[model samples]
Target: MSVTKKVILITGGSSGIGKAVGIYLSQKGYIVYGTTRNVANYSNFIHFPLLTLDVTKTDTIKKAVNDLIAKEGRIDVLVNNAGVGITGPVEEIPDNEICNHFETNYFGAIKVMKGVLPQMRKQKTGLIINVTSIAGYMGLPFRGVYSASKAALEVTTEAIRMEVMSFGIKVANLAPGDFATNIAGGRYHAPVIEGSDYQKNYQMSLDLMDAHVDDGGDPKEVGIIIEKIIQTPNPRIHYKVGAFMQKFSVFLKRILPDKTYEKLLLNHYKL
Candidate 1:
């Protein structure tokens, strides 16, 4: 691969937004490297490259970085897109459940960042786009774990952006709203089953959560926005991607008082 061509490494690129972005970027002349847990059952419009990686595994991350460097000579962009959500009340969530969420969503991104930062600094030109979510901006009840993980990622992105500017390495985050993806199926299920003390409320919350997941917009829209951001000369620090929910959430938090906003959310969720 030519070093002059844009080389991008995307985690969780096997399907959904990541895969869609890979197809689009490949068509646009980027040498895209995508990572997935399952490299066997793959089908796509393009035949770029697929690397096997379980984001929680540090050795896998190191191997991917080393392999990419050896083959491409340099990486121009790294998209930290591999993440999983775990939704439940803080009280009801088990210690292991919380750790699992952090393992993939928070630390997985950090691991990839750490592995790539040295190379980016050495090259003095690179871009890191973290696939965070609108949940990063606000903490929604029952989805505390997911929101907190994304929130941490957003903060890390901001801090790194400030620190890496002199190196000409840009760090930007895409905070997408609800999108049609398998993320819900991929989310960690809290170990606390039914009939426990928190069961009634948790069950109610689960039902409400189901409603929101069903209301998701298309993942293709998010994919197109990501492509645009990548192709832009200078991307913003953070962008909210999706339909009116993106704007409405920010407005609700900024304009409405806390109690009022809570009530509105409760009414919307039918809680």
Candidate 2:
């Protein structure tokens, strides 16, 4: 019997890492369906079909998944790549803004997962790759909210991996560090009050964040990693992709003393 080509669904595919993955996977012969909030605007730009999806909206998430399944009959892989970043001092960050960050970065992913799980459960085979960040592992100085949001997703991904293993559904967290993308343009800056204690430090940290992204690793590298993961029958649970120093930081966080790790992080960020 000939193996059927897998149907893959990727969220936030209008640009950045998600767009690269969609283009690469579609070129590799898989039926790739990418989701974007403004499909009308992005439809002409992307190579593959673009589904209208706003991850924070449950109705849109459902419609996007249903539309893909109605046409393709199955969604073999789901990449939860949709997320937003919020930056500033934790104390000054508004509650609603923090909620918004979680809504898009964490809860939005959960909504998409719920939308696709039933079909994968019925088919008894599937793969879920959550595109998280190295910041998820360690909270950055100004990007605390963004880090916390990804960290929440990382923990949730672990739980889902165990829960779905019995149903032949494999789950993995893809942690990337500082990729060249338009993420800075989309990031929300917390309101900084005049004379606030964290003003100078926050500005310095924010500038460093932007510089890291500007000089970051190529996002195509991440796309290549996603393609490989899609082809693997039994993939590992966690994959960290990025520069050697970033990957090593994760390892160091695990082994170093709390104070020692804090010093290392401080030195790296020039804090």
Candidate 3:
């Protein structure tokens, strides 16, 4: 390995968008280190080196960063791509599950960011790309918690960008609308109560969400977008990847009245 090659660390690279991005970047000549909770299970499949890391655990995150720094000397880019989805009506969703959702989707990203910042600051040049979701901009039906978690991440990314700019460390949020992945399988759903009013609607909304993901954009496209961002001299703070409507929806939400936007969302989800 060339010492001059940039070292990139991406979390949750065992599958889906993360894996695609990791493989793509590695192929582009960057030294990529993708992290997963269980390296043993995915060691054979992952193309790049896999580091054992559970972003939800601070100790594990720190250890992963240290391990990478020890071998690579410096990390040039850190992509916070590990996340989970949870679906349910707010009233019916358990508090603990919501907490877990935020722990992985929001706080876990922050923990990894913190772990990598020290090294980035020492180097005085680095990039942090957080993989959020378009749902962050507009809360989707039944997927309220997941939307909220990503929303929180988007806001945090903004603040971190301003704070780290002086250090020559750039931060950006890549809000992908929908990409075909196994995320549907890992998503947490609220249990339907026998007589709960939301039971029927909840199921409908969950199905709609799953269908969108099933017919979503390709994960390789997202990987290409990430690669472009990496190659750019200075990337924007927010990048949206998906179909035209998905990206336009964010613009529409910005200009449309509150009720009008809500109505559009309701109609789209068939709620």
Candidate 4:
């Protein structure tokens, strides 16, 4: 590994914010590798190497991390960005789908961290940036499952950061707002079944969510923030990048009463 250029591994880098960040880092001369479940689909990918990784599977996670270590000799940074989205009323969402959302967004990120920590410990210095969401700050209407999954990672990141501090490993969560990504298309949504109690409200929230993503900011800005965070000698445990109202909503939650916040959210979603 080149002393001046760090090796970065970003999971779920095939598209969206992950791809944006990976490409930005690679363009600036960092040695970068992005991961996707199916590599054959990206045979001609030119931005940086896209390795085979399926965060849902432990075997694939180990292989990707080990192979990168073998080739690079050290893994300096890991952006645990692989995750899926689920939308619908919490009660209406199927149990399996809720489990699957956590499987990839929560457990999968943990597995990847487990795979890389050994090498980072050996090096005595490394950084892991877990990509969470601004939504994780609060329970959003129709996005409850996705919110919970990211929130789980957020709290876990806080706990693990302390556990590994003595080893010289720094962990942080990057919570991004909508970023004009393909997440909406890939997101799982419970059918808007007619006459169901949640049918009308769920549809309203779903449409609002789609519009937010469609009007999201450039994802490369997140890459820029990642670069800054990597440069900081000691990075904070939490970082958020998004529109003013989106970030402000977090502040509101802290100061307002519980029901007050709930009312505000209900109003925003027009429920």
Candidate 5:
């Protein structure tokens, strides 16, 4: 592949936002490498080269990073986008599911950073963009697990920005609102058990969640925002991308009274 202004590594790049980012950046002339859990599965389908990297597995992370650096000499950007979606009433969600959710969405992202930060530090310049979500800004009704996991990443990125600034590495969190992607199909939804207190509300949320994704904006919009962030000289600590109301929800939570905001959420979810 021909080189460009930057070499970007995007995890979970095989599909959804990750795939969109790879395609957009590659078209814009950036050398882009996307990672998937299994490269063989996407060999015939992907537009760009994909590396085998499972964020939950340290060995795979190390191999993917090493292989990239060995080929590209240095990595100028790392987009920690590999993550899975989980949604359910916090009370009913199984412990294993929660653990697995954090394993991929939160811990997996951190490990990916650990794999690439060393190379970035050596180069003395790099950008790490952690893809979070607008839902992270508030505790959504039944999406408690999903909100918490993304929120964790957002908070961690804030601290990481400070710690790595001296090393000339910039860390930022890009929280996208609902985007049209295959994420709905892959999400972990805790069983809507009969006779449970949350049965009705949980089912309503699950349906709403899927509907939102189906009606969400194009995934490439995220790539557009990411490209802008890459072009920026000193990118901000946090960025949001999505529809008017979805992003506005975040701002609303900040300015509105606590109970007022809770009421607004309750009304939206039809609880």
Candidate 6:
């Protein structure tokens, strides 16, 4: 292996879309470094290095960035893919739960980005891709907190893109629709909830989540699209990738009036 191949590091690469992205990028001749909390249990893949990293820890981010720099000399791309989801009414979710959600999904990405930005600035060429969600665009019932976190990520990426454009650093957002990822299965909930308060709303949220699993797109397909975006001469600010129907939803939201859009969402949720 070359001392330094087209290097890229991805967080939360243990499974689902992150794992698929690692595999696809490695197959395409890019040296891929994936970070996850568990390094012992993993599939064997050629030319892909799995590192142990806890995104919420600043120390872990610093060490991981330094290790990559020492080994590869230059980091080319950093994909902020680590995140968690919480589903419930805003009032029902404890304040601490909201903070924890942002800790992993928003601030964790910031920590990694802060550590790597200095190195990229020194080199004057790099790409930072933040994995946001379609919910970033429009809020969903029972998903207000998750949507807020992703929306924050999107806005942060836009600001970073502007600030780094002149320095040859690119920042882009990937707003994916529902996909077959562990996002639903691996979600964390507030311990405060005991299934009594807001039971009806909570039940509706659970039903919607189940429906998403049934209708989600394949992670491998989204992985392929990420590869294409990385290879493009100039990547867009945001890439919306998923089934054609999801694209149609974006179109509908754009064309429909505010009341009409609200009605559509209400109908979908049977509210």
Which one wins on lDDT? 4
TM accuracy, model 5:
0.98
Q: Distance from true position, residue 153, model 3, in Å?
A: 0.8
lDDT minimum window of 10 residues, candidate 2 = 1-10
lDDT for 122 (candidate 6): 98
Q: Which stretches of model 1 miss by more than 4 angstroms?
A: 1-4, 38-47
- Model 5, runs deviating above 4 Å: 1-3
Please, what are the lDDT tens digits per residue for candidate 6 over residues 1-271? Answer: 2423668999998787888888878777788999987677665644378887888898888988899999989888888898888888787788888899999999999898998999999998888999998888888888889989999999999999999888889889998888877777788654435567767667776878768866798887766777777777689998888777676777888899989998988888777
Tens-digit lDDT string for candidate 3 (237-258):
8999999999999999999999
TM-score of each: 0.90, 0.96, 0.96, 0.98, 0.98, 0.91
lDDT by candidate, in order shown: 0.83, 0.89, 0.90, 0.93, 0.92, 0.83
Residue ranges of candidate 3 with Cα displaced over 4 Å: 1-4
lDDT of 2 by residue, 1-271 (tens): 1133789899998888898888888777888888999888864684889999999999998899889989989999999998887898989988999888888999999999999999999999999999999989998788888989889999999999999999999999999998999999899988666798887778888888899899998898887898888778888878989999999999999999999999988897787
Candidate 4 regions off by >4 Å? Answer: 1-4
Model 5: per-residue Cα lDDT over 148-207, one tens digit each: 999999999999999999999999999999999999999888889999999998899789
User: Any idea what lDDT model 5 has?
Assistant: 0.92
Ranking by lDDT: 4, 5, 3, 2, 6, 1
Alpha-carbon RMSD to native, per candidate:
2.6, 1.4, 1.6, 1.1, 1.5, 2.6
User: For model 2, what is the alpha-carbon lDDT of residue 94?
Assistant: 86
Model 6 misplacement above 4 A:
1-4, 41-47, 190-197
For residue 28, model 6's alpha carbon misses the true position, in angstroms, by 1.4
Reference-based lDDT, residue 135, model 6: 82
